[model samples]
Target: MLETLVKNSRTSVDAGVYEIRGAARGGRSIKWKEGRAALITEVKLASPSAGWIREGADPEEIAASMVRGGADALSVLTQPLLFHGSPEYFARVRRSVDVPMIMKDIIVDEAQVAAAEALGADYMLLIQSVFDGGYAHNMDEFIEMGHNRGVRTLLEVHTAAEFERAQNTEADLIGINNRNLDTLEIDLGTTEEILAGRNTRSRVISESGIKSAADIARLKKAGAAGFLVGSGIMGGRDIEGTVREMISAC
Candidate 1:
């Protein structure tokens, strides 16, 4: 499934034209709120690990609930096969939410950056592991493409070594995904383990396995400027309350 997504993304559109078409006008900048850890609540339908997160859930409604709960930013999963996400869902969330949004997907090509911008996303995710595994795409190129199209970039890294690689890029925002792609397992320690004693100007975001206020505090102490939490809120019965509690925890 991963290979197929990468293959299709590589040839899905003409990069040059898509870059031009991706140009857009406005989006809210991600500024961490005072006295609270920046919260980037996500609109995810499913995942390869959890599966069927919230079947038939409405992305726009979820986004609105998140905003009401004081989310600083939003992330919309755009991967279709494994995550059951779509660009249309992203567009809806963008229209409904008045916050910075990151188009979270397995971005393997520059065209995906174009797609994110065309859909009005404020930022696009770039996974270093994808390129490290010998993919033909370049992260720097995609970063430049997003900047040209009026979008920012969030480079994701899962390991300390990957964090080192991320430092090589000009990406200003960095995310540490606690969920391991290979094992599909999550450990809160992953974020701290990767960021321990590290100093950099980039904003560090901890993703996944954020269940309670304590968890948020732990990550904050570990040096995360913000968090990208999804399933905890999306899979819960009370999304608004969950978002509020998570924000308060931060």
Candidate 2:
């Protein structure tokens, strides 16, 4: 499924670039203020591990709820085949909320970066491991493409080696994903294990498996500047109330 998504995305590179060039650009810039762990709530519809999360969910409604709940930013999944998301979801949510929106997808081509800009995304994700899979081959060029379009890149890494490689890039943010892609297992300790005894000035965002306010506080103590919680909030009955609790914990 991942391979097919990468193949299809690469084939539309030129078209994606052309579309973004013709589209207007302007969105809220993220400001990670001190004294709180910035929250990046996600508008995800489904995943391989969790299957359909919030089936038939409204992206705009969920985004607004997140914003009202005090989310610092939003991450909207755009991987259609597996995640059941589309660029239109980002656009829909953009119109509903003013917070920074992240184009959360397994980006494999520059065209997707352009699509993100055209869709009004304030930030886009670039996974370091995908380079090994023949996607995002030119890491520097990929990062530059987003930067040139005024879209900040969030370099996501799952291992220590990937983290090391991500550190060399000029990414606006660094995300440490606790969920192992292969096993689909999440361990919050992964965030601590990687950040232990490290001195990183760059903003660090802990991703995956964050369940409660204590989880946020633990990561904050481990040097994480923010938290990206998706299923924990989206799968819940009350998104706004859950988000508020998470924010207050931060």
Instruction: Give the winner by lDDT.
Output: 2
Mind giving the per-residue lDDT tens digits that candidate 2 earns over 68-178?
A: 999999999887766788777877787777788899888876668778878878899888778866766898888888888888888888887788778888998999999
Best-fitting candidate, scored by TM-score: 2
Tell how far residue 158 is off in model 2, in angstroms. 0.7
| Model 1, runs deviating above 4 Å | 1-25
* Candidate 1, pairs of clashing residues: none
Q: Each candidate: what lDDT?
A: 0.82, 0.83
Give per-model TM-scores: 0.91, 0.92
Locate the minimum summed-lDDT window of 10 residues in model 1: 14-23
List model 1 lDDT by residue over 1-250, tens digit each: 4455565455444333234343334456898666666999999989877889899988888899999998898999877767888777887777676788888887776667778878888888887777887765677888888888788889988999999989888886989989876677889999999889989668889999998888999999998999999988898998999999988878
Model 1 CA lDDT for position 161: 95
